[model samples]
Target: VKSGAGYLPVDPSYPADRVEFMLADAAPVAAISWSGRELVLPAGLPVVDIDAVDVSEFDGSVVSDADRVAPLRSSNVAYVIYTSGSTGRPKGVQVPHTTVAKLFANTESVYGFDESDVWTMFHSYAFDFSVWELWGPLLYGGTLVVVDYVTSRSPEQFLELLAAERVTVLNQTPSAFYQLAEADRLASESGRAAELSLRWVVFGGEALELRRLSDWYGRRGDFAPTLVNMYGITETTVHVSHRVLDAALVADASASVVGQAISGLQVFVLDTRLAPVPVGVAGEMYVSGVQLARGYLGQAGLTSTRFVANPFNAGEVLYRTGDVASWNSAGDLEYLGRADDQVKIRGFRIEIGEIESAVLADVSVAQTAV
Candidate 1:
């Protein structure tokens, strides 16, 4: 948004039909693409190939003139991130500049991001997790090593990249980390372990079963490269709650413990009527505060249903997350998966995540889908 233009990151690997559908929904004025990629765009949609941009001939001093300025407002929409809808089509979420700034502004102390760190941009820009992975280093003047597709797919290769680049901050999904941990174990057992410089490994995009990391903890421990599980969604500006995973919590935590809301944001577990549920009671999750997205773009009806007026506040709004959660006795929130993600078995309802967690608890189980 440096040039006051928002970006809608389309998955480079999406099929032509899928790409066209996203283009129609976002209605971006122009598409920006890098070299060596085939893009399918709507009719007459302006496309700019960044590889062909010849800005080298331009005088840097003139374009970088100190007086030449157009400041961006905090309310200005920074990007449009599309999230999957129940109807199959994706709905674009309008995230403002302020919403993004609010995330780091409140959690900078907790994250301890700085200029000395080196991060790897591993996830696709289309995924909201990439927002955290991309901006964390740039905003702090830190170095960012872009992971190639080949390396991203292989845990052994990724581990090699981390050691070669001396990457300090890493973000990954638990599923991906499982293999990497296994690779680390193998390397250690073979007496060929690569020295890692990671200081933090942030997890998101799914519920993390801490018990699965027993072997990893036994090897690396929890003190270094502090492992944190951040519960997040695209509409809520990436993260809703932050929980540092420790040996004690890993052994005791039954469900995914998302911990508490970051400083500026407010997350409440409320009943169907929007009334706050008592401690340890499961209910739908609602988020309120500055980080909330503007709403689903061009989908007024859908926006109204998802983002409703806050019952506790006079004129504020809350984004109904459709997530099931409850507060623990320690006042920390525990994520119980999506509210609508239940399966009926012989007239009894069971959350799919609960079953998945049980299956994952098996030491021999590598992955599961139920």
Candidate 2:
């Protein structure tokens, strides 16, 4: 990321057909993967196997003036993350360097990320959550511990690994964190609870279940590693708002509180006509800020439909989040649910219509409903 070269991360667990589709969508200059792994990449696309060549063979090399790399600008594309499209294809969201940078701007002051911290890269590289997990530590001069897929799936083992690695900052989806919290509870009951070094627990990728955190708080109390829940989207570049949870906040289950907007972004709960709704009234969410993505790649119509011009600010655009939310009496945005059929289960946004359409494509099936 520091080299200013845009990269498209492909999930290793994705099927060959999905991988092929992503490769076609991104149209990357070259593909890189581990040596000996047979990947179904686009035909004629150059493949760079990182393990196939020895880096020591090309030491002390410098590019000449003619071959010098161009200076990177903030507007340059940083990466492309593909999200499942309602049209039965995945659409790539082109995020610029400025957008990603805005996420970390002044975050250190608020979150206290420093060189002494040790963070874990817990999410899949293809997932937008990994954008923060992978770079947050690196940008802050902290060590990033990588968790393997197998270990990550097993909550008990993952907890043991976190303790062994002395991870200070942990980022997890609410669903995944619940599993870890359960594992910790079991360990505590068995009189074998490991002493962890975690100082911060940041939750994202899904709506946090405040009730599910009772077990964790019962064991660790309210202060040890501060728990924070953030609500975000891929098009908004990651997180827009974050709520720092405490014993009082978690116990008060009045609403799906997702906290207030972070720096560099604005969140609006608007009516169907795109006008701001009164406080305490449910409305669709519209986000406008520096962190907004450029737009969906090769999807001008979809982009236009979702990202509309901001009437308040000339030449500025706002992304229609399609999430039903409202400003509660407490002055925090409370998430109600999706405005449409988009379901967020276990951190994955799934369109029910898309699945139904896929099932209907089979010749044997006359009709189907999701």
RMSD of each: 7.6, 1.9
Best by lDDT: 2
**For model 2, where is the 10-residue window of minimal lDDT?**
59-68
Query: In candidate 1, which residue pairs get closer than 3 Å at backbone N, Cα or C atoms, i.e. clash?
Result: none
Off by over 4 Å in 1: 57-71, 341-370
Each model's lDDT comes to: 0.84, 0.87
TM-score of 1: 0.88
Error of 2 at 162 (Å): 1.4
Kindly provide the TM-score of model 2 when superposed on the true structure, using C-alpha atoms. Answer: 0.95
lDDT of 2 by residue, 224-265 (tens): 889988999999988989888987778877666899889888
lDDT accuracy of residue 361 in candidate 2:
85
Give per-residue CA lDDT, model 1, range 139-181, as digits (tens): 9999999999999999999999999999999998888888899
